[model samples]
Every structure is written in structure tokens, then in C-alpha cells.
Target: MRPLKRLVEQFLESEAKGGILLFVTALAAFVLSNSPWAQAYFDLRDVYLKLQVGDWVLKKTLLHFVNDFLMALFFLLVGLELKREILQGELKNPRQAGLAVAAALGGMVTPALIYTAFNYGGEGAAGWGVPMATDIAFALGVLSLLGKRVPLSLKVFLTALAIVDDLGAVLVIALFYTSQLNVTALLVAALVFGFALLLGALRVRSLTVYMLVGLVLWYYVLLSGVHATIAGVLLAFAIPIGRARPLPPHADGVAEDPELHEAQLELLEDAAREAQSPLHRLEHLLHPYVAYFIMPVFAFFNAGVALEGAQVGSIALGIFFGLLLGKPLGILLFSYLAVRLGIARLPSGVGWGAIAGVGLVAGVGFTMALFIAGLAFDAALLDEAKLGVLSASVTAAVLGSLLLWKTAAPRPS
Candidate 1:
């Protein structure tokens, strides 16, 4: 338990630093997009890339490789984090998880509904899922700016909420954004998934073996037209949650010798440490790469929307208002209802106003929103949606920071 707690703490600390880097990279991207080097930026993203093995070949632009292949790694990390939280982190307790769950649901539903009201039965209706995401890195980055003005409990609450929000986004992508299905490929993916599970059941702790099978699964799922990122999530669940088993008091020949008992216990501890599941190891190893490298590169590629001829029409307006207005409104309203109904209680040292402020911060839905926009709209409408996401994310970050700074109590001197 202490080890798990330490791992979570390390995760948050790295995330805070990563958030700063993400901001810097996004800013650089925006600058490059609007400057004289814009054509070079676009050209770099459009460069064709291909992989061939024998007669089989896969081809895509550089940007698609980033979006499809690299982002799948990002989602793989997300899935591992979600699994860890559910198994032993904050979400392990029902009461502790209730507030985040309710807040995430409201955050997702209200944004979708608000977007739908504007684009219902229209071409942009498919984009209702765009504003439903919360960029955890950006939101936490903003929160970290406040120093100790915010409580640790509040930060944990926000983190949990964002994780739940991510889960919702994953579901939406799997259910709504998927293209045509290929049954044969899906069966192949299933067979690979089953083999991975069998490895876990057999307690094969070699990460190399699991990863090899996972790559096969990812390829099959990619061919199945089910949005290949789902394969990452599926692979995550197959990884064993190997908790350390306690050493029995009367093991082997320790009954008559106290020193031998202590020696045996130490050996057991060492074995237990080594027995930690691949999920934890992979999550730890990949988190830094995902945060510092993959995400910043992703932002550089995806967030460079040209503002010269960009028009903010109804689609953009819907996304803007959905993120800016609908996010906070739904989060605060549902949270209040949950508290009043005794479904969940606020964290200690946190007030309704702070929660409202956090809700506003959750509206900084940049990365995931941009990714969904790519899926939800054509090239023409994609620019409009990106503009809305960029504008709303900035507004939400500013407003939420102000609200929290003004309302939060100062730390004890």
C-alpha cells in the first residue's frame, strides 16, 4: 500500500512538471503555425511515411502516424493509470470515488447536450463528443501555478475527476467514432487478446512476451476498423495486478531459529518486490515519455490551426460554449446535487466554490478535444473545431485560475 501510494505521488509530481513542458510546446506550435515558417510546418506534417513487409504495406502521412500510432501509446498509458486507480488508488473506495464519478458524468453529459442543442440534426452533431474531454496535463498545470493555495485533497479530487473524464472519452471514441467493422480482423484481435490473458493466468511475468502479443493484438484491432486505441485499453486489463503476498510465519525451517526467520522474511520481501505486475512497471516507464515527448509532439502537430482565414461559425460556437459554459455549469450543478442527496461529500478543506472553480479548470479540454475534432469533422470543419477548442481552453484556464485564486484560503503560515 505504501509503495502504491508513493507511485501515485510520483505520478502527480511528474505530471505537474510535464504540464509546464506541454504548455511550452503548445505555445511553440501556435507560434510556428502563425509565423512565416507555417508552410514548412504544414509540409512536415504532410510528409508521406510507409512501412512494407513482403507484399503487405501500410502508408500514412507523418501526422496520421503520430495520431494513430503514437496516440495509441498515449492511450495505453491512460488505460494503465485507470486500471491502477481502480485497483488500489483513490478510486479503490466507493465513497472516495463518488464525487469524481458524478462530476465526470456531468462534465461529459452537459457538454454533449449543449453542443447538440446547437448542432442537432446538423453536420456537426457528430462532434458533440469533442468538448466532453478534460486535458489532465493542462488542468493540473494550471492548478500547480497556484502553489499551496489549493489543498492536496482538492488536487486529488481534480485528478480523479480527470481520470473518470478520460474513461468517458475513451468510451465515446470506441462506441461512436469507430468506422466500418471487419469481423475477421476482430476475431484475430480477440484471439490475441485471449492469448495475452492466458499468459497472465500462467503468471508469465516477462514484459517482452506480453508486449509482443500486445503488438499483434494492436495490429489486428487496427485492421478491424474499431479504432486501434481500444487495443491499448484491452491489453491493459490483461496485465496482472500482482500484489505482494505476505510471508507466512512458519515457512520452511524458520520455526526453531529467529535469525533464520528474519533472513527468510527479507528474501520473501525481495521476491515480492520483484513480483510487481508489468502494468505498474510499464506505467512508470512510459509515463515520462508520454508526458514529455509524445504529448508535446502531438500538440505541435495537431494544435497548429491557421487563424488567417479561419471562420468561427455555428460549429465553432457550439464547441466554444459547450466547453466554456456547459462544463462548469454541469460540474457544479451535479456535484451540488450529489452532496445534497448524500451520494458524495466534498473533500475536507474544499468548498463548493472551489469545486466550481475546479469544474471551470476541467474545461481546458485541449489535447483530447483536438483529437476528437479530427475524427468528428471533415478537413473544412476540423479547422473551425480546433479554433473553438483553442479559444475555449485559454478562456477556461484563465477564468478558472482567477476564480480559484480569489476564493481559496491561504495556507497556514
Candidate 2:
């Protein structure tokens, strides 16, 4: 429980900053798009930037690099979190993960169905997956602002659900969003993957080896027409799980200290104190990168969507209802049905109100939704989709915050 509390604290702190950046960038994009400099703002995103140092040269639009390369790192961090949780956190146990899994599935499916219902068999049907994601940083950020009013169980539920939501979003992107595949590039990607797997099996401890191979994998995947971010997830699985356990020079199985006799207990304590286990060290090293760099950069890049002079019609209404209403209903109903059918149990200290509020929070799909929207449509409908996402996400964020804030009794210091 102590470890869980600490994790929550760390998650909240980082999420607060990341969420603010997301909101600010989004707002800036909207304002700039609507302002007199709208045409220039649009052009600037497409303006090519190039860097050359002798034979080494790199070129891409600012948006392309940010969306393609930087976002891959973001997905990498997400993959790490998912892996950690499945290995040692709340998701390790099937029973413990049941409620969250059910809720997340419910949240995702319901919004998608609602979206599909509105845009069925039309150009908008491709956008069904847009509302299926839950932005963890923003949702957690809103919860954090409410302080101790929200219960710890609610927070835990939201985190687990969001992780599941992320998994679903990734799958949707890979399966539904992809177009024609480049078989040659895919073959190369497979070869690179095999090398990564071999390194993992050999328990290689050097990150440099992984980094170089990961870059190759990313390039191959990018060309293969599969989203490059998928490479991040694949590479995360390949990271070697080894610990650095330093052994001291032993003298004929005797303790180095004259005062301490040759005792097994003494040796064990020394080993424990000196050895920084592989999992422990990797987690420590990855934590700061995930919390600070990967998440913030992703937010800064992906959160930007032009919001000025947007239509407020069926699209906006549909999105708003799907997130704020449909999400909670779908999540709660499916979860309830699952429990009633004897498939799962409600988490301890978690009630209807909490679950409902979490469902609403899960509706806040600002980041992932926009990314999927970009893939679902060409330039024509992109603006409308962006408008729908922005309005729905804003609505979900505010409603979820208010709902959870009301439920959380002030905890005494």
C-alpha cells in the first residue's frame, strides 16, 4: 500500500505538469488557427526543417518529426508502464485487474458504438475509434487538483482503466488505421525484432545496444506502413531484464570484518545492501524519463489542434454525449453485468459513484483520439474531427472533475 501510494503521488505530480502543457498547446493551436495569422500558422506546421552536418542530414516537416519520431518515445514509455504493471503492479493478479479491465472495455466499446451510430456507413464511420481512448495525464491531473477529496481506490481504478484504454487504442491504430504494407520493410523489421529478442535472451545490460537496434526497428516499421509507435511497444518487450548484483571479494568464505564472524546472516545482509537488482535499477532509471520527458513531449506535440471557428452541430453533440454520457453508462453497465454474471468482483472501497465518475474520466480522450483522427481522415474532415475531440474532451474533463470532486470527502491532514 505504501508503494502504491508513492506511485500515485509520483504519477499525479508528473501528470499535473503534462496536462497543463497539453491544455496550453491545444489552446494555442486553436487561438492561432482562428487569428489573422491562421494561414501562416497552418503553413508553419508544414514548413520543412532540415539539419545537416557533413554527410549526416535529416529533413522533415516540424509536425511530421514530432508526430512520427517523438510520439514513438511517448508510446515507448506507455509500453514500459504497461509492462511494469502486468509484471508487478495491480495487473499482475487476474482478480485484482478484473474491475479495471471490465470498466475500460466498457468505456471503449460504448463510446465507439455511439460514435459509429452517428456516423455509420459514411465518411465518419472511420472515426469510431477516436473516442475510445482515455488521456491519463489530463484525467489524473484533474483528479490531483481536487487533492484528497477523491478516494485512493478511485485513483487506482482510473489508472488501471487508462492503461487498458491505451492498450485498446494501440491495437485499433495498428489494425484499423494502417493502409498498404511494405513487405520488404516489414521483413527487415522482423529481422531487427529477432535481434532485439536475441539480446534480451542473452541478458545484455547495455542500453546502447538496444537504442541502436531500436532506431533501425523504428525506421523499418515506419516504412512498413505500420505506425512507428508500434515499434516502441515491441522494443519495450525486448529490453533485457538483468540486475547489477556486485559481489565483494570473499576471503575463504569468511567475513572481511574482524568483529563479524563468518556468519551466513551477515553475508546475506551485505549481499542485499550491495546488490542493486536489475529490475529495481531499470525501474529507477526509466521512471524519470517516462514521467518528465516522454509524456510532456508527447503532450506538447500531439495536443495541438486548431479549434477556432469550429462548427457546433451533430458532431460536437455526438462527441459530447458519447464521452460524458455514453462512456459512464457503457462502463458501469458492462461492469455491473460482468459482476452479476459472476465473472468479476467489485474492488474494495469502490462504489457506484466512484465507478461512474471514473467512467466519465475515461471519456477524456484528448491526446490519443486526435492521433487516431489524423489517421482516420485526410485533410478534408480533419478540422471537424479535431473540433469534435476538443469539445468532447473538455466536457468530459470538466464533468468528471466535478463529479469526482463532489464524491471525495476532505481527508484530514
Candidate 3:
């Protein structure tokens, strides 16, 4: 249990660092997009890259590769984290998970409703999912800024809530953002997924075998038009969760065998340490690359919105209100109701004001919002949505920081 707690602490620290880097890269992208080098930056993103295997060829812009392939890796990491939490981390306890789950659901539903209210029956209606996300990196980064003012429990609550929010966004992408499905490709993907499951059931602990099969599954899912990132999630569930076997009790004649008992206990401890599964190993290995490189690159490629002709009318307004107003309103409302109805309770030292502040922070929906907007809007309206996302994210971060700063307790003397 101590080891697990330490692991969680390490994970949060890493996430905080990565969140700061994400902000820097995003800021840089915004600046570069508005500078004299804007055209060159755009051109670089638009450059086509092709992959060939004999006569078979696939081509896409550099931006497409970043979004489709690299972002799949990002989602894969997310899936692994989700799996870990469900099996061993925060979500493993229903009492602890209830608040985060309720908050995430409300967070997603409210933003969609708000956006849909503004764009109902209009061309921008499909973009309702755009504001449903909470950028975990940005949100955590902001909380980290407050230092000891905010309670550790509040930080953990926010982190867990954001993760649940991410899961919701992934589901929306898989369900709504997909193109017309190709049955043949989907069947192939299903077969591969079943095989992967079979291997896991057989306790096959080889990472290479799982990865090879996962790549094939990803290819099929991509061809199936189901938003290839779903493949990442599927692959994650196939990873085995290994644990050390419990030792049998000592024989009756061994009543005085203290040395043997101690040695057995040591062996058990070592075995348990080694029992960590492939899921943990992969998550540990890939977190830095995903956080430091893939996400920053994704932001650089996707966050460069040209503001010259950008409009702030219906689509933009919907997005702004959905994030700024809808997010906090929903999170606070649902959380309050949950507590009132005995469904969930706030963490110790977390008050209504702090929850409100965290909800506002959750409104920093940059990366996922941008990804969904790209899928949901046409080129003409993409910039409008991007403008809204950028503005709302900045506004949320500032407002949330100020609110938390004012409401949070001072550091211990």
C-alpha cells in the first residue's frame, strides 16, 4: 500500500511537470501562428507524408499524422492510466470514485447542452462535443501553481475528475465523430481484439506479442472509420494484470522457525515487487515521451489558429459560454446535488468555494477541445471554434487560479 501511494505521488508530480510544458508549447504555437512566420508554420503542417509497402501506399499531411497516429499513442497512455486507476488507484474504491464520476458526467453533459442550445439546427450543432473536455495537463499545471494553498486531497480529486472527463471525451469521439464504418475492416479489428484477449487470458506476459497484435488492430480500426484512438483503449484492456501468489501457512512442526518465516516473508515481498504487470511497465516507459514530446508536438501542430479572419459569432459564443459558464455550473450543481442526495461527499478540507474553483479550472479545455473541433467543424468554422477554445481556456485558467488562491488556505508555518 505504501508503494502504491508513492507511485501515485510520482504520477501526479510527473503530470504537473508535463502540464507546465504543455502550456509553454501551446503558448509558443499561439505566438508563432500570429507572427510573421505564420505562413511557414502552416505550410510545414500541411506538408504531405506518405508510407508505402510494396504497391500499397498511404498519404496524409504532417498534421494528419500527428493527430491520427501520434495522438493514438497519447490515448494509449490515457487508457493505461485508466486501467491502472480502475484496478489499483483512485477509481478502485467506489466511495472515492463517486464524486469524480458524478462531476465528470455533469461536466460533459452540461457543456454539450449549452453548446447545443446555441447551435441547435445550425451548421455548428455538430461541434457540441468541442467544449466537453477538461485539459488535464493545463488544469493540473494551474493547481500546481497554487502550491500548498490548495489541499492535496483537492488536487487528487481534480486529477481523478479530469481523467473521468477524458474517458467521457474518448467515448464521444468513438460514438459520434466516426465516419461511415466499413464492416470488413471492423470485423478484422474485432478478430484481432479477440485474439489479443485470448492471449491475455492465457497469461501471456510478452509485451512484444501484444504490441504487434495491437498495431494490426489499430490498422483495422483506422480502416474501419471508428477513430483509430479507440484501438489504443482496446489494446490497454488486453494487457495482463499480474500479482504475486500468496504463500501457504507454515507446517505445525515449524512453530519455532522464526528465521524461515522471515526469509519467506522477504521472498514474498520480492515476488510482489516483481509482480507488477506489463501495463505498469509500459505506462512508466511511455509517460515521458507522450507527455514531453507527442502532446507538445500535437499542440504545436493543431493549436496554430489564424486569427486574421476569425469570427466570434454563434459558434465561438457557444464554445465560450459552454466552457466558461456551463462547465462550472454543471460541476458544482451535480456535485452539490450528489452530496445532498447522499450519492457522494466532498473531500476533507474541500469546500463549496474550492469545488467551484476546480470546476472553473476544469473549463481549461484546450487540447481535447481542439481535437474535437477539428472533427466537428468545417475549415471555414474551425478557426472560429479555435478562437473560442483559446479564449475560454485562458479565461478559465486565470479565473480559476484567482478563485482558488483566494479561497485556499495558507501554507502551514
Candidate 4:
């Protein structure tokens, strides 16, 4: 219980801080895009920035490298979180998982349907997946602002729902957003993946070994026309989940030998403790890397969308309605139906008000939506998707925060 409480506290704090950073980054992007130096702001990406050495060199447009390479680390952290949750978190339990899975499916399907309704049989039809995302950071941040008023069960539900939402986004990218497959590159990627699995089977524990091989996998996947970020997800599955040792029972306050136990009890207790196990240490070591470095860098790169003139046209309308309406509609409707039909029960200590508030918060789809939009189209339609994403995300954030905050007071016991 102590560890669980600490985990929740840390998660909330990190998410709240990330939200503040995101707000500043987005505001800067909007101002820079609309300012007198707009061209310079845009052209900042085109300027050459490289590391030149005798035998090694690296060069890329400022934004291109940030968006592609830096974002991969973000995806890598995401992949790790997904893997951890599937193994040991709320997702590890079937009944606990079912509600979130159903709600996420409803959230995704309804939004796509809504977006399709707006852009069906039109040039911008492929943009339907744009609104089917829920940014976990923003949602968690909103919940954090509500403090102890919001129940722990509600936070868990939101996290579970977002995890499932991410799974859906991964599928959408793999199925619909991919381009012409490059068989040769894909074959190379497969071989690299095979090598990673081979290392895992050999019980390689060093991250450096995986990192070296992962870079090759990342390159091959990038060239394979499958979204490069998916490589991060695939690679995370190969990482080992072995723990170092099990906690031993304390020998204190109990007779060791019954005949002559009191004298030896302290020694037995000292020998039995295994609190600083290898696996526990590893989890602690990795947690900081995932929380601080990977996520913040991802936000800095991906969240900086050039918000120039707001596109309040068909695209923006489609995005806003899809998220604000679709997320809650899907979450509440499917959740209620599941409970009513006896498919799943509402989690203990959570009320409809908390669940509904979380559903609203789940509509804020900043990171994943932007990533999908990039995959769904090139520069031409990219702006339209971005417009939709920005509008819908802002609307979701504002309304979701309000609803959740408003409902955080004393509820029917």
C-alpha cells in the first residue's frame, strides 16, 4: 500500500508538470507561427545543424530529426508502460481490463464514425482516425488538479482506458496509416527483430546491447514504410521481465528453533531480508528514465504544432465534435451497457460522476492524435488534421477539466 500510494503520487506530479510544459510549448508555437518572424520560425527547421567529424557525420533538418528520432524514445517509453501494465497493472486482471477495453473500443469506433460522417467520401476522409485518441498526460494532469476529491478508482480507470486507447491507435497506424511496404527493408527489420529476440533468449540484461540492436531495427523499420514508432513498441516486448529475488519472511518476533531461538532470531531476520532485490532496483532505475527524460522530450518535439490561422472549417468541426462527443458517449454508453448486461461491473469506490468526468478528460488527444495525423497524410492535408487535432484537444481539455473539477465534491456515499 505504501508503494502503491507513492506510485500514484509520483505519477500525478509528473503529469501535472508535463501539462504545464505542454501549455507553454503550444502557446509558443502559436505565437511564433503568427508573429512577424513566422517565416524564420518555420525556416528554423531548414537550417543545417550537424555534427561533422573525420569518419562520422550526422545531419538533418532541425524539426525533421526532432520529430522522427526524438519521438521514437517517447514511443519507447510508451511501449514500456504498455508492457508493464499488461504484465502487472490493472490490465493484468481480466475483469478490470474488460471495462476499459470496451470503453476504449466504443470511444474509438464512435469518434471514427463521427469523423467519417463529416468527411465521408471526401478528399479528407482518411483523416477519420485523427480524433480517436486520448492523451494520457493531459487527462492525468486534470485529475491531479482535483487532488483527493477524485477517487483513486477513477484515476485507475482513466489510466486503464488510456492504455486501451493507445492500443487502438497502434492498430490504426498499422492497418490504415501505413504506406507502400518496402519488402527489402521489412525483411531487414525482421532480421534485426529476430536478433533482438535471440538476445533476449540468451538472457542479455544490459540495455546497451538492446540499444545498439534497436537502432538498427529503428532504421530498417523507418525505411520499411511501417510507422517507425511501432518499432519501439515491438522492441519493448523483447525486454526481460525477470526479478532478482523474492522477499524473504522476517524471522523477528518468532521462535527460530523453539528450543534455543531467541538468541539466533536477530541473525535469522538479517539473513532473511531481501528487500533490495535486483528487480526492484531495476524498476526504480528505469522509472525515472521513462518518466522524466522520454516523455518530456517527446512532448517538446511533438506538441509544438505551428498554430497559425485556426481552421474553423469542416476539418476543425469534424475533429472537435468527434472527440468532445465521441469519447464520453462511447465510454459512458458502453460502460453502462456492460454493467447492465453483466459483462463487467463498475469498479468499487467509483461513481457515475467520476467515470463521466474521466470520459470527458479522455477526449483530449494531443500526442497520439498528432502522431496519427502525421502518418495519415503528407504536408498538404497534414495542416487540416493538425487544425482538427488542436481544436478538438483544447475543447476536450477545457470541458473535461471543468466537469471533473466540478464533480469532485462530496458524492452520494
Candidate 5:
């Protein structure tokens, strides 16, 4: 139990550090883009790369590769986290989950409405999805800096809210952002995804089998005119999280038989390893890589467009106001409505002040916002989109962090 607790602490610490690294990398990329060497940066971003495996080939620009391939991996991790949370984590409790679920829904809808209002029936209207995301890494990273000033309940609330927000974004991308679908490719992907689910239902435990099957699934999904990242989520849902049982606690005393005690410890550790679900295992294995590498790379590559010649239309205004104003308003209003209607209550040790602060934190939609913007807008409008994302992210981070800093009291001396 102690070791598990320690591991959770270490994981959060590592994630916080990773988020900081992502921010720094993004800042560097943004600076380089606007600098005199902007042409070189743009050239590298636009440079095409190719990979071939026998009869099949994949060729895309450096930016496309990062956004499609790497971000798919990022979404895979997100999907795994979502699964675990729904099954055993904060989302498992119906009452506690209600607040977050409602808040996340409001957060997503409000941002889209705000963006739509500004760009209605215009060329930028498609970008309504731009501000609908909440980057959990960036938001949680800010909370980590507050230490015990923030309550664990508030953090848990935020985590659950972010997970729901991610699921919403995934649906929006799949339903609204897809292109002309290829029927044959769609059929193939559906069949593969179904087979993968059958394998999970049969309790297949070999990681290699799942990965191989997942590669095929990804290929078909990518070819089916759906965003490639949705493949990651579908694969995640297909992976089995086998049933887990709690181990019996040992009596707290010196053992009469030393050898027996040592054996029990070994057996317990082995049980612990085997008891973990494939979903949990994959999530643990992939989180660090996603945090430290994939996300940072995606941010650097996707968020570096020059701001000088940007198309500063209603699209920019829509995104900025959506994130800065709409996110908090939606979250706060919906949450209170839920409470008033007897749907959910505030978590223990949390107040409306903390919820408000968390609402602002939810506005830090950096990585996902940029990714969706890339999908929503074409090259002509990308620079403006990136500008709005970058500016809103920074401003939200400052406001959210400050609000939470004041709302959450410091640890007792």
C-alpha cells in the first residue's frame, strides 16, 4: 500500500515536470517561428517525409506526421486514462462524477457556441471546435505548483472534468470533422475494431497480439476518412481491463515463521502485478512517453506558425473569447445548475470558490486546441488559429493559477 501511494506521488511529480517541459518547448517553437529564422523553421515543418513497409507507404510533411502519428499516441494514452477512471478512479462514483460530467459538457458546448457566434456563416465558422478542449497536463501542472494550497478533492474534481472534456472532444472530431468516408475502408475498420473487442472479451493477455491488431486497426481507420487519432481511442476501448480483486491485508505483527512471511510478501507482489489490468499497464507504460516526448513534439511542431501574416479575423476573436470567457462561465453555471437540481454536490473540502478557480483552469486548452484547430482550419487560416490558441493559453494559465493560488489556502505551519 505504501509503495503504491509512493508511486502515485512520483507519477504526479513526473507529469508536472513533463508539462513544464512541454510549455518551454512550445514557447521556444513560437519564438523561433517569429524570429528572423522563420523561413528555416517553416521549411523544416513543411518538409515531406516518407516511410515504406514492403508494398505500403506513408508520406506526409513533418507537421502531418507529428499531428497524425504522434498525436494518435497521445490520444491512446488519454483513452486509457479515461477507461481506468471510468472503471475504478474518480469517475466510478456516480454522485461525485455528476458534477464533473456536467461541468465538462457545459465547458465544451459553451466554447463552441461562443466561437460560433463570432464566426457564424462565415469562412471561419468551421473552427467552432477550437476552444472546446481542456489540456489536463497544463491545467494540472499549474495545480502542482500550488502544493497543499489546493485540496485533493478539488484536484480530483478537475481531473475527472478534464477526462470527460477529452471524451467530448473525441466525439466532436469523429462526428463533425470527418471528410468523405470510404465505404470499404470503413467496413474494414469496423470489422477490425469488432474483432479486437472480441479478443478482449476472450481475455487475451498478450500485449504483442493487441499491438499488432491495433496497427491494422489504425491503418484502416486512417484510410476511412476519419481522423487518425480516433483509432487510438477505439483501440483503447477494445483493450480489456480484466477483473481485479482486492488482496487480503496481513495481520500487523512479527511473523511466527520468517520464511512463510517472506514468501507471502513475494506472493503478494506477484499478485499485485498480475492483478493490474492491461488498460492500467498500458497507461502506466505510455504516460511518461506521451507526456515527456509526444506532447512536447506535437506542441513544438503544431504551435509554431508565424503570427506576422496571420488572418486575424473573427476566428481569432472567437477562440480567444471562447476560452477566456465562455469556459469558466459554462462550467460554473452548469455546475451550480446541477447542484440546484439535486444532480450532484460539491466534493468534500471544496467550495464554489475552488470550482470557479477550476473552471478557469479548464480554459488552458493548449495541445488539444491546437490539434483541433489544425483539423478545423486550412493553411490560409492556420496562423490566426495558432495565434489565438497561444495567446488564450498563456492568459488562461496566468488567470487560473492566480485564482486557485488565492482560493486555496497554504498548508498549516
Candidate 6:
């Protein structure tokens, strides 16, 4: 429990920093794209990259590499977090998880319906999945800015809700976004994926083995017309987490004995690390990279939608309204119904206003929304969708943060 608590704190702090960095990168990219160097900015995204292994070759632009390859790591991190929550964190208990689970369902369905309502029978209709996501880092970053003014319960609720939302987004990508399939490639991917899962059941703790299997699974999935990124999630489940044990209150183990030798302290430190599950170790290892490097680079490439001559059409409007209005409406409505029907209850220190505020924050769908927009729309409609996501994300952040700040009850000093 002590280790888990530390991990949670680390996650929150890392996200705050990462969210700020993402803002800076996205702004810089946007400015470059719309400035005199617009051509160069777009060209950078189009820079072709290639890798070959004998008869097998993989080639994609810089944008595709970031989106396809780097983003697989992002999803891997997401999968790890999702697994932790389901196994032992907030989602472990159905009683405690009911409210967040219900709210996440509402968050997903309402936005998709709202987007579909506006773009029904239109070219943009396929992009309904764009608004049905929550950028947890950005949302949690806002809460971090507010400091102790907000209850800890609110943060927990938001985290749980966003994770459930992530799972929904994963499903959407796997089911709806796939294109024409190559049966042979899919069959191979499936068999490889099953073998990886079997490793976990066999209690194999070798990270190297799982990773080797994952690479093969990824290539086959990519060739099968299924998104390769989904392999990240599958790999996550395949990695075996060793037995769980709570670390000491002080990691050094020297805290309790000031006279201990330096060599003894070093041994204690090593023992502490060994006690952690592979999931925890891997998650900690990847957190810094995902937050500081991969995600910001992804933002630089994907968020740079040229604003000049960009027409705001049904796609933009649908995403905007779906994120702004539909997100809050669905969350609040479902949460209220759940509580009223005795299916769920509000957190100890939370109220209707906080719930509403959280629903708005969940509308900060910048990362996943942009990723889905790329999948659902081509060059012609992609810019418009990006515009909608950017505008809605900023609006939701400001509005949600202010509401949470104002409505929060004063806590004891």
C-alpha cells in the first residue's frame, strides 16, 4: 500500500508536468504550422522513415511513426495503468467503482450520439468516436493546479472515470476503426497473441520473453489491417506481475537504523526494488518517457492543424458540442440516476457541483480525440476535426477548473 501510494503521487506529479509540456509543444507546433514556416512544419510531419529486416520492410512518414509506433508505447502505458486499477486500485471493487463506471459509460455514449446527431449521413459521421475520450493527464493537471482546494476523492473519481473511458476508446478503435483484413496475417497475429497471454497464465516473469512476443504480434497485427497499437494493450495483459508486497515506509530501510553500513543500505534498496511486481516496475520506468518525451513529441506532430483557410464544418461543430455539452450532460445525468436508483453513491466529500465539474474536465479529450480523428478522417476532414478538439479541450479545461474551484467546500486546515 505504501508503494502504491507513492506510485500514485508520482503519476499525478508526472502528469502535471507532462500536461504543461504538451501545451507548450502543441502551441509551438500550431504557430509553426500557421506561420511563414508552414510548409516546413508540414514537411517535417511528412518526412518518410523506413526500417527493413531481410524481405520484411516497414515504411511510414514521421507522423505515422509517431502515431503508429510511439503511440503504441503510449497505449502500453495506458494498458498497464488500466490493469493496475482493475487488479488492485480504484476499479478493483465493484461497490466503489460503480459510480465511475456508470459515469464513464455515459461519457462515452453521449458524446458519440451527440457527434452522430450533427454529422449523421454526412462524411464526418464516422468521426463520432473522436469526442468520446478524456485526456487524464490534462484533466489531472488542472486538478493539481487547484491544489488542496479540491478533495482527494474527486481526484480518485476522475482518475477512475478516465481509465474506464480509455478502455472504451480502446474498444472503439479495435472494433470500429479496423479496415480490410488480411486473413492470413490476422490468424497469425491471433495465434501469437494467444501464446503471449498463455505466458502470463504460466506465471512466466521474464519481461524479455513477453516483449519479443509482442514485437511479432505487433507486426502481424499491423499487416492484418488491425491497428498495431492494440497489440500494446494485449502485451500489457501478457506481462506477468510477480507477487505483490508493500514496501517499507522509508525505502532506504536505513531510516530505522542510522548506524547501518553503506553496503547494508545498498542491499536494502535492492531488496525493496525486487519486491515490486513487474507491472509496477515497468509502469514506473515508462512513466517519465511517456509523459515527458513521447506524448509531447506526439503533440508536436499531431496537434499542428493549420488554421488558415480551415473551414469549420459539421465535423468541428459536432465534436465541439459533443465534448462541451454532451459530455457533462451525459455524466451528470447518469451519475444522478445511478445514485438515485441506489446503484452508486457520490464520494464522501463530493457533491453534485463537483460531479458536474468533473464531467466537464472529462471533456478534455485532446490526445485520444486527435488520434481517433486521424483514424476516422482523411486529409480533407482531419484539420477541421483537430480544430474542434483543440477548441473544446481548452474550453473544457478553463470552465471545469473554475467550476471545481468555486464549488468546492472549504476543508479543515
Q: Please tell me which predicted candidate would have the highest lDDT against the true structure.
A: 6
Worst 10-residue lDDT window for candidate 3 reads 246-255
lDDT, candidate 3, 167-281, per-residue tens: 9999999999999999999999999999999988887877899889989998999999998878988998888776434334442123348768777666665655467577877
TM-score of 2: 0.85
Clashing pairs in 6: none
94-157, model 6: which lDDT tens digit per residue? 7668888999999999999999999999989899999999998888888888988788778888
Q: Which stretches of candidate 5 lie over 4 Å from their true place?
A: 1-11, 243-267, 410-413
Q: Alpha-carbon error at 10 in model 6, in Å?
A: 1.8
Tens digits of per-residue lDDT, candidate 1, 1-413, equal 56556666677778888888888888888888899999999999999999999999999899998888888888888888888889877788787788889899999999989999999998888999999999999999998899888877788888999999999999999999999999999999999999988887877777788788888988999999888878888888888777445434443334358767777778766665575678877887788899999999999999998899999887888898899999999899888888888878888888888998999999999989998999899988998999999899999999999999977665465
lDDT, candidate 4, 98-129, per-residue tens: 88888898899888888889988877788889
List residue ranges in candidate 4 displaced over 4 A.
48-59, 247-310, 410-413
Could you tell me the TM-score of candidate 6? Answer: 0.95
Model 2, 220-325: lDDT tens digits are 9989999988898788778754455665655226655766665755776567544643334445666566556655555545444565545565555556677777
Instruction: List candidate 6 stretches off by more than 4 Å.
Output: 1-3, 244-257, 261-264
Q: Which number leads on TM-score?
A: 6
| lDDT, residue 21, candidate 2 | 63
Q: Is candidate 2 or candidate 5 better by TM-score?
A: 5
Which rank order by lDDT, best down to worst?
6, 3, 1, 5, 2, 4
Provide the lDDT at 349 for model 5. 72
Between candidates 3 and 4, name the one with more favorable TM-score: 3
The regions of model 3 sitting more than 4 angstroms off are 244-273, 410-413
TM-scores vs. true structure, each candidate: 0.92, 0.85, 0.92, 0.86, 0.93, 0.95
Q: Give the local distance difference test score of model 1.
A: 0.87
Which 10 residues in a row give candidate 6 its minimum summed lDDT?
247-256
Q: Write the per-residue lDDT of candidate 5 for residues 1-413, one digit (tens) a residue.
A: 56544655665677678779889999889899999998898899889999999998989999888888888888888888789789877788887788989999999999999999999999999999989999988888888988888876787788889989999999999998999998899999999999999999987877778889888888898899999889899989988887455554662333569878887777777777677778878888888899999999988888787767677779989999899888999999999999999989998777787788889888889998998998898889888988888888888888988998887664354
Q: Which stretches of candidate 1 lie over 4 Å from their true place?
A: 1-6, 244-273, 410-413
Instruction: State the local distance difference test value for candidate 3.
Output: 0.87
RMSD of each: 4.1, 5.2, 4.3, 4.9, 2.5, 2.0
